[model samples]
Target chain A: MEDNQIKNNSNESQKASANYDVVIIGGGPAGSTAAIYAARSGLKTLVVDKGLTSGALGITSKIVNYPGIVEEISGAQLVEKMREQAKLFGAEYISDKVIGVDLQSETKSIFGNGGVYNSRFVIISTGSMGRGVRIQGEDRLLGHGVSYCATCDAAFYRNKDVVVAGNTDEAIEEALFLTKYANQVYFLSQTERLAAPQELVETLKNHPKVILYAGTKLKEIIGENRVEAVLAVQSDQHEVLLSVSGAFVYLQGGRPVTDFIQGQLEVSQSGCLIVDSSFQTSIPGVYAIGDVLCTHVKQVVVSAAEGAIAAMAIEKEINGRSRMMVDWSEKKQ
Target chain B: MNSVIHVNDDQFEEVVLKAELPVLVDFWAPWCGPCRMVAPLLDKIASEYSGKIIVAKVNTDENSQWAVNYRVQGIPTMLFISKGQVVKTQVGALSESGLKNLVNDFLAGKN
Candidate 1:
């Protein structure tokens, strides 16, 4: 009798989730923007979000250069507003981690722990979380000290020394977050220059607790049970060992989050989905956009634009399919 | 219990350990942000699994005995108790769906 009640509760939601015309897979800026456009175009749209602060933008502390916005806003706030706008325009949003996808057939299917969704057109707006620094002891001591998300694990290292490897936007933003709890933070960059935004770069350059390192390669993470120090090589051919309790590695050359769709899509050498000009992948009804594609710039505005373009293209395809001409004159004869 | 019951130090054993069904005890505090966020989710799960599981919360401030006994060092720590013994413990706040998955798995004896 108790099992029947649980089944009934789930079945109610499953029945409400009808077939969608366009299903945008990620609930980031790219996917939300796509949902806003697609839903406004009179198409049934659904956006699936991987809960647990899982979006690339959610990790971003602040974003100032998106154009039209006067003041700086946090990434999570901006994404929330975008989702709200999409919802206002009649886009359904659900929080579920997608486990697998089957886009070969006419009706593309997405499988998740929550439920399975079928759509005629599918958009893959799932962003990339750049490559990981695979130095010695990095993988073995993952939860011990090394962490990928500063928001999730920064609280564990209160008033302790930590190292943030790499100089990308994510790296610098996470380094800033670490400065809150960490007594001292070392921002290590392998290249000759830092790739973070000028505003953040300037802030880190003058911060009292932040120490910046340029033209340095992280060689190893030293520790017994937890992170103890980091071994690095400078441009002057000098080796330096910095003592730190925690290390946050943000490596260069990031790939898309396409492991679930590994056997389904035709990805490039760098793991980016190979899509045509219309953001349509090798499969006709399947589309991909944002950092997951082989695009040059990875700005939020660029991803939003790609989403708009993909939505318009999908609308056109849906309309064309309805008006598709078939010759049944021979059968009648 | 179908609804969320406040279990204090005096009533912890009777309300949770002695319950016929499996119990999930939430060790939380008022000031903790993640603990406040997970309260509603636990309530929803309690109602969904009414007869199958008993969900209860114990405020660490008012009830420190159980928290200290379980060695719960963090806020929003959830203890999955079965047969009067804790089978699993999870720390931190999870999404609604994440909690649902965990509860469903535990109910199915997959834990």
Candidate 2:
């Protein structure tokens, strides 16, 4: 009976999902710009973003160099403005983290944490804040003990020791979650003090199951098959090894965000997505822009310009046009 | 015609370990992001490879007993069991082709 209910519910949800003409990932300058151009061109567009501050522009304190905006503005506020503009142009924005994608099929399917979206075109503008380097044995023990998601794997480590590395709020929240299942939770922050909110930090510090290790660098993950221990350096001299069954690493690095693609698309040597002059990737109907490009200039105007190019290219492809459409002419006035 | 069975702690032995064919058991929950990503793929495999293999899902949120017994320290942990013995394990989301390759390898005894 329950199985039938589940199947029916899944089918209903799948039916509820509306097919879109374009699905843009990341709502930063590039993604929002793409949404604006695509939606204004009468194409049904949807933008899926993790959050306001998920991209580099989101974390930027002040963006004064952006053209047409004389006032000093925060990256988050600027992004919000772009998002609003895109929405005004008929783009639907949803706050959801894209977990995976299947771009080979005619209708590309983007899987998010909340729901799935199907579209004719996909834009890759997730930026360069993705993790690039892996500690020793981290890759080998990925399924065994090394995991990026704590919520997914924390339950499996019941009564076992685990380590949560990183200083972000996400890492702290995961560490706190692990306390419920794991016998002990070791919180390792590379910084002297975590940049996350103070209340969350205090809670993690005061938690009975947590052992806080600040200003530590994770040197390596020591294990044969699964995670047996973690080798870390404290204060640049002291080496600490903690026995653990799991290692939840939320570390961030400066590389193109392509993990979600799962090696289906082409990337450059530095892990940046390779795109043509039109911002179209190696795969047809797929586009990439902004900081995800290796030669990308990390500027708001640059990203926005790239987004415009990609969106126009997408519009051209969708309409089967040999020449690109120039919309600068006064709109039939 | 059998889809992926939502096997519980009690039915695990009979429905999976003692199944007629090898079973690809997925330890998952609704809240897990990667688990959500693997769900649709598992459904397709369950239907397409019905007689060749059994795709069993153990929702760890409710049925943690078997998951604990298997020492599955990850969600979406696919344990390939042949003849009631664990043969292979994959612990995260894979691309569509990646999943297909893993399934083919599991069926080919190369896992």
Q: Which candidate is the best by lDDT?
A: 2
Off by over 4 Å in 1: A1-124, A127-129, A132-146, A152-156, A217-242, A258-287, A290-309, A313-333, B1-45, B51-111
lDDT of 1 by residue, A1-333 (tens): 432433453465465357999988887888988998898778999998663135667657789999887788877778888899999989998765465576777887675534567899999987886354479998766656776656445655778899999766557777886787789999888877665456767998888999999998888999976788999999998999999988888674456777557457777786667889878888998888887775547788989988888888888888776442332557858
Q: Tell how far residue A241 is off in model 1, in angstroms.
A: 4.7
lDDT of 2 at B16: 88
Error of 2 at A188 (Å): 3.5
TM values, all candidates:
0.50, 0.79
Displacement of the residue A121 alpha carbon in candidate 1, Å: 11
- For candidate 1, write residues B1-111 as lDDT tens digits: 479889999999898999889988998765443555577779999898888899999987568898768755455679889878988776666666677888888878788
Model 2 DockQ class:
acceptable
Q: What's the fnat for candidate 1, on a 0 to 1 scale? A: 0.00
- Steric clash pairs (candidate 1): A130-A254, A131-A254
- Give the C-alpha miss distance for residue B76 in model 1, angstroms: 7.4
Worst 10 residues of 2 chain B by lDDT: B28-37
